[model samples]
Target: MDNIYIYMLIALAFLAVADLVVGVSNDAVNFLNSAIGSKAISFKTIMIVASLGVALGALSSSGMMEVARKGIFNPGEFMFDEIMIIFTAVMITDILLLDFFNTLGLPTSTTVSIVFELLGASVCIAILKISADDSQSLLHLGEYINNSKALEIILGILLSVVIAFSIGAIIQFFARLLLSFNFQNKPSWYGAIFSGIAVSSILYFILVKGVKNATFMPDTLKDLVSSSPFQVIGVSFLLFTVISYLIIKFTKNNIYTIIIIIGTFALAVAFAGNDLVNFIGVPIAAFNSYEAWSASGVLPSNYAMVALNQPVGTKPILLLIAGLIMVLTLWFSSKAKAVVKTSVDLSRQDNVKERFEPNFLSRSIVRLSMTASEKFNSLLTPGSKRFIDKQFAKPVQALKTKSEDMPAFDLVRAAVNLMVASILISLATSMKLPLSTTYVTFMVAMGTSLADRAWGSESAVYRVAGVLNVIGGWFFTALSAFVAAAIMAIVLYYGRVYALTGLLILAIVLLIKNYLSHKKQSREQKEADSLERSESSSTQGVIIESAKNISNVVKRGNKIYSSAINGLATQDLKALKKNKKNITKLSNEIDDLRDNIFYFIKNLEEPSLAASNFYINILSFLQDMAQSLDYISSVSYKHIHNNHKKLKFTQIKELQEIDAVMETLFGDIKSAFASNSFTEIGTILAEKKSIINLVTEKIQKQVERTRSEESSPKNTTLYFSMLLETKDLLNATMNLLEEYHSAHDEKVAPARLPGSADPSLEEE
Candidate 1:
């Protein structure tokens, strides 16, 4: 029994390492997004700079580990056994929750997760203790828990979102107006002033947020800061501003580059300084509790954890090791890039396609914003409106090198993003208020994107949706963190040994699964792009490219459909999930092909723009086929995942038959497209119709069975939906075959040739 506490202390130390890796992966987006987005520095250089900041920040951290000790609950009220259980549960929950968010590439507040987790796990135990003791009433829960402190943290996090967004928007708008998009031609003074302000903010951030918590800071200096905060900040600002102005005059340098590098370092420092508690705080707290118990020379359940309420110093060496782990994760973790990409895609200035689909809420918000803009413009005088519009206009051409590799925003905005975010967060830190760095930095970047008009009409809805999705995830983090911690705490309390073993095993499994999944996805992405670009310089080339794409669709579609059927019949969700992933990659490829229509058209000969039109039609059908397969495979996986009733045996047999017919039809379609002959188009079309009829019959039988024999609504829906989606999938394949046949036979009259002659005007 005594050995359990020792085992738990060991577990806490181990979980801390895992937590640091996952926590840094999620939080990397906050500091790295701006640097990565701007491409101001080389990838290696940016990483090295950020890594150093994390290491330094970790060393300087105030060791907010006290928060885990007693910030959420009254640690003095609990025995060593209970405190160990609660702390252990927190370590498990924090690592799992952070890792889950990282795997999904969403940036959530580690502050929120850890705080709510402590609150939750503590609250659960408090309830149990009250229930077991007649003297302790539910009304006296506050004596055991620190609900007030937890509420304050929650409210502070919520407040920072609105504040960060508003401040970011206003400052960014003026910054852009002062230094327009094409500010390179502007006077040097304009750039200097921008650099001055940016550098000043970051300087303030470092002093206020980054260093105040340094474990090595002398007591006298801490007292001096406490005594005259304003005087200290003023001196720092003056020095940074002077340096900024001197750099402007002394060198023909890119001052924006200087600002970005400095700002990146500051934010990284702030992250490690302030956010370290979210990772190793609980483990350190548990270690402290263990030490206290050992010194007491009492039984585990007899000793109280009263010392937890007092602040304890964290070992600088331990901080250094945690910092090293974070730095390594930054340099090596593949998921860091994924998280960074999500931020960049949302805030990028180019016309690249959006990753998130727009919903009604996003569309409505965009529409309302457009309406307000129109009304505001109407109120302005013509001259004033024209002046404002010009400031916001995108330049006719941007400076160029590798546009593909260029940052989402320029150095100016990147510097502003890093500087302003650091200032805001540092101020909060100085005031002893809890400001979520992730929430602040992410919102500030978004706010600046809005001001720069990166969220134009073409992408506003998607950008808004992306922002909303991330914000929603933050709230989910709080909820999930709390509930999961509470549950784990209860399990640890009653089923101590078995629960610990089960949870540790579960955490290891999930981490391995996500790691392998992420790696496989990376490989798949490379393979998808490595396939030859379907170039179309001439009508012949166009036909050949179309055949290749068509062949791919046919081949992939058959496999996807077959995989869904077999997996469903066997209840193998893993196979079904893999198939769903394949379908998604295929759909993304078609979307890329569609997005390239302009370039494909530009490459065509004057008389061969007709090839563009043909290529467009071919891609359209292929996209539809891909989508149908996506729906089928995804729904099948969901049904099986929910443990829904399996389809009747007869229904499975029917699906097997339909899968065979679809396979044959896909083969025929592939041969016709490969030969560009479509001599077998009639045969393929006939086979498609036959397969559709076969599925329709199955669907009808299911309907009848539902009315008389079948009772499960989910089972009915699952079977019917697959059959219907399969029908659509078949029709799409046949349509592409017909489209190819038409493209192959058309011959426009040369006497009055246009770039694109309609098929109706072509000679027979």
Candidate 2:
């Protein structure tokens, strides 16, 4: 039993490190999103600045360690053994929960998870204690819990969401109104004043609020800040204002960019300073309890954890090591980039791909907002309206830039996002509230985006939906954390060494599973034969791009069509289901190409304007082909999934025959497009009639079977459907081939290749 505790301690130390990795992966979005979104500075510089902040912030996080010990529960009420169980449960739960969120690329609150885990685990252990004592009832559970502090932390986290958003929106609205989109051309004083306010706020929080909690700081310095915070603020403001003015006048750099850089550093510090307890605090507390027990030479269960109730400083070496792990994770974690991308995509200024779909709630919110805006505008005079409109107008050059090259938003909005998040997080940290940096940073970014009018009518509902989904995930985090930690506590308390071993194994397995799953998903995305949007401005350029896409489509389409036929032949539901997924991916790729038609048309050169027509026709045919495949996959999977009667042998044979012929034809089509052999397409087009005849013959034979030998209506209906859709598929494929061949002939003479330069073909 004595040896078991040592192993538990070792396990805890490992869990602490794992928790830090996953926790940082999720929370990196809190500090990284604003700088990464603005694109004001090179990525290397922003990361170096953020890395420094995280390092210092982790060092200053010692005072917060007490929260994990006695903030949620009355540690003195539990024995050393029970306390160990609770700590183990919390660490286990935290690692799994945070990693789950990181894997999904959603930002969730580590503060909420750690806080609720402590509460849940303690409550579970307390309940067992109460049950063991006949004198104590369930109501006496309050004696073991710190209800007030727990409630305060919970409410503070929930309230930060609303407060952060409101403040962010109000500040960003005014900032945009003051600076406008073309703030670069503003007077030097205007830029200096803005820079002054932003820099002063960041510095005040970083020095006064952040350093106040550092374990290494001298008592006199803490006392000085405790006495004259306002004095410190005034001096900082005056000094930075002069500095800002000098920088703006002497150099041509943008002040908002400087603010963004400072804000990134500030938020990183705030996150590490405040949220570090959520990762390592439990293990440190458990280690202290063990030391207190070992020193007393008392039995583990009989030795009460009175030592944990008192505040103890963490070793600076441990903090440094933890900080080192965080910085490494910040730099190298792919999941961190994913979580940051989610935040940036939601707040991008221009229309781009939306990861979330608009739901009814999002749609209603957008509608009500539009109606309110109209009502408010009715009260403004024409001049006032025109002035406001001009101030909100985006620059034409920005609109014309490719979305990949354009920043997610301008530096002013980015500055507001950072400054607002920094203030809220700093305030919460100074008060030792364990405020959720994830909530503060994410909502602030969203609010700033709304104020900056990044959520236009076209994207407003989708963006709103993404926001609502994230908020919903936050609430889910709290609920799940509480339930899961409580369950783990009970298991650990009863099973002891056995339960700990099982859970450690389970956590390891789950972490490995998530890792492999994410890697597989990323690999598929990178290597998948997905269609690409055309970025060309010439007919020849369009042809080259479209040829690659057409080849990809036909290649994937062949596999999907053959899978549906084979699945129907064998009645393999699992194969059919996977085949449906593949086809859907193909369909979605085609849909994405269709969505890019606007940009494709806009990018075309004037002389090659005719290529737009040719490109549109190709997409239409491709879409038709995809739809045919989608229908085939859907019905095939549905028939098998619903346990419908399998087709007879003769029916299966006929379908397989059709599949063989179509496979040959699609192979030739893919080869033609892949090799850019437009002339070979003429042969495929000539053979298209034979393919259609084969499908027609299949349908005629299926009808005769239905009239005479067919017993199942489901089979007959399915057979007829497959034959007809296959006919449509063949026609769409041939139409695409003919369209390409005709366009090739018109552009290049019969004596030359498709892209050969011909004097007669040049419009000029």
Candidate 3:
């Protein structure tokens, strides 16, 4: 029995390390998003600063471990064995929940997960204790739980979301008004003041509020900070203001960049100090419980976990090891980058590819906002409104910059994001609230973007949808964490060692599966022969770029057409389902290409205005082909999915023959486009009549079969639908070839008509 406890301890040690890796992956975005979004400094520099903050913050995190030990539940109420079960359950649930969110690239609160997991597991154990005792009843459950602290932590975290967003928005609106979009041309003193306030706020919260809880802080300094925080604030503000002014006056360096660098470090420190407990606190508490049990010389079931109720200091070495793991994860984890990208994309100042789609709620919100804006503007004087418009007007340079070089937002917004998020998170840490870093940072970024008008009419709906999706996921995290941890506690309580072995195996399998799935998805995105947009400015450049897209479309469209025929003939439902997905993806790629037509035209050289016509025609033909294929795939899949009868043998054979001929034509078209041999397109055009006739013949045969030998009305309908769509599909493919062939002819023809051989037709 004692040996099993030792094994549990070993398992927990590993879980703690694993939890740190996953927790950091989700939380890295909290500190890194602002600097990365603004492009304030080199990424290497940001990481170095953040890494240092994490190292120091981990050392200070010793005080936070109390939350996991006794903050969520009354630990003295549980025997050592029961306490172990609760701890084990919480660790398993926390790691899995955080990893799941990370894999989805959505930032969720690690603080919320850890707190709820502890609450759930302990509550489960408490219920068992009450049920087994004759005197103890349902009313006695509160004695086993720290309901007051649990409620406070939950309420604090929820309240922080609203507070962070409001403060961020108000500060940003004023900051933008003060600096305007042309802040770079403003007087040096203007920037110095902004930088001074931003940097000073970060320092005060991180040093006074955050560091006052550090294990290594001297008593005198903590006392000084606690007793005279206002004095510290005033002095720091004055000192940083002078320093900022000197830097601006003496050098060409941007002061906002300096603030972002310092702010990143401050937030990183606060994250580690507040969130480290979410990762390792449970395991450390478990270790302490085991020590107490062993030394008592009593059976584990009989020994109470009284030691957990008192304060216990965490070993510095353990904190250091956990910090090292987090720093490394911050530097290397691809998931961390993905989570950061989500926040940055949502808050970007200009449009890029939106990762989410608009929903009804988002649409309604945008409409209401527009209505309110109109009403608000009616209340403003004309002069005031004009002044506000001028202040918010973005510079022309912001519009012309290349996408890869453009920052997500200006440095001012980034500074505000960092300053607000760091202050809020550090303040929570000071009060021992364990407020969610993810929640505070993410909402602050969103709020700043909203205030800066980054979410313009073109992007407002999609951005709102993305925000709502993420918020929905957070609520899911809380409920799922509570339920899962409770269930795990029950299993561990009764099944003991066998249950532990099964769960460990299950966790290993799930982690491996998620990693491989993410890797495969990344590889597919890179290697897929998807359609691409034309970025060419000249006619010749457009021809080359657009030809590549045409070739890819032809190649993919061929496979999808063929798959539909084959899957239908065999009634292979799985293959048909996959074929539907393939066709839809191809169709969406074409749509994306069409969406870039505005930019394509804008980028065209004056001499290449004709190229726009050719490009648009090519896209239209490609869309036609995709629409045909999409219809075919959809109807085919629907037929098989409904368990409708397969087509008759003759009908199947005729469709297969059409598929073969269509495949040959598509192969020829693909080859012509791929090699830039527009001459071959002429040959493909010649066979267009034959291919269309073949599809017509299939339609005719299906009609005859339907009229005479068709026994099932459903089969007749499906066969006729496939035949007709195949005919449309052939026409679209042939039209694309014809269009390409004609464009080639126009390219190679003499600049003047053949009649220009006459001297009068020639230019003087």
Give the candidate number with the greatest lDDT.
2
Error of 1 at 615 (Å): 3.6
> Which lDDT tens digits does candidate 1 get at residues 360-455?
999999999999989987899999877777887766444222235656888768977997798788778778897789999999999999988899
- The reply for model 1, stretches above 4 Å from the true place, is 215-242, 245-251, 398-406, 529-551, 558-585, 595-611, 624-764
Of candidate 2, the 10-residue stretch with the lowest lDDT total is: 755-764
- lDDT of prediction 2: 0.86
Q: Count the clashes in each prediction.
A: 0, 0, 0
TM-score of each predicted structure versus truth: 0.81, 0.96, 0.93
Give a tens-digit lDDT track for model 3, residues 718-763.
8878888877877877777777667657665534332123232121
lDDT by residue (1-764, candidate 2, tens digit) is 77888988999999999999999999999889988888999989989999999999988875436778888888889999999999999999999999999999999999888889988999999999999999999999999999998778778877888898889988998998899999999899888888888888887777655666786789987776667767777887788888899999998777888898888888788778867878888898888888999999889989988888778888888889999999999998888988999999999998877889999999999999999989999999999899888999988766433646668888888888887876776666666675777898899999999988889998999999999999999989989999999999999999999999999999999999998998887787787486777878878777777888999998899999999988888888889989988988888878878877777777668875689899999999999999999999998998999899999888899899989998899888888777676767776788877778888988888888778888998888888889899998988988888889888787766565543344443332
Report, for every candidate in turn, its global Cα lDDT versus the true structure: 0.82, 0.86, 0.84
Off by over 4 Å in 2: 215-221, 431-434, 607-609, 750-764
Candidate 2: TM-score? 0.96
TM accuracy, model 1: 0.81
Off by over 4 Å in 3: 215-220, 400-405, 431-434, 607-609, 744-764
* Pick by lDDT: 1 or 2, better one: 2
lDDT of 1 at 380: 91
Comparing 1 with 3 on lDDT, the higher-scoring candidate is 3
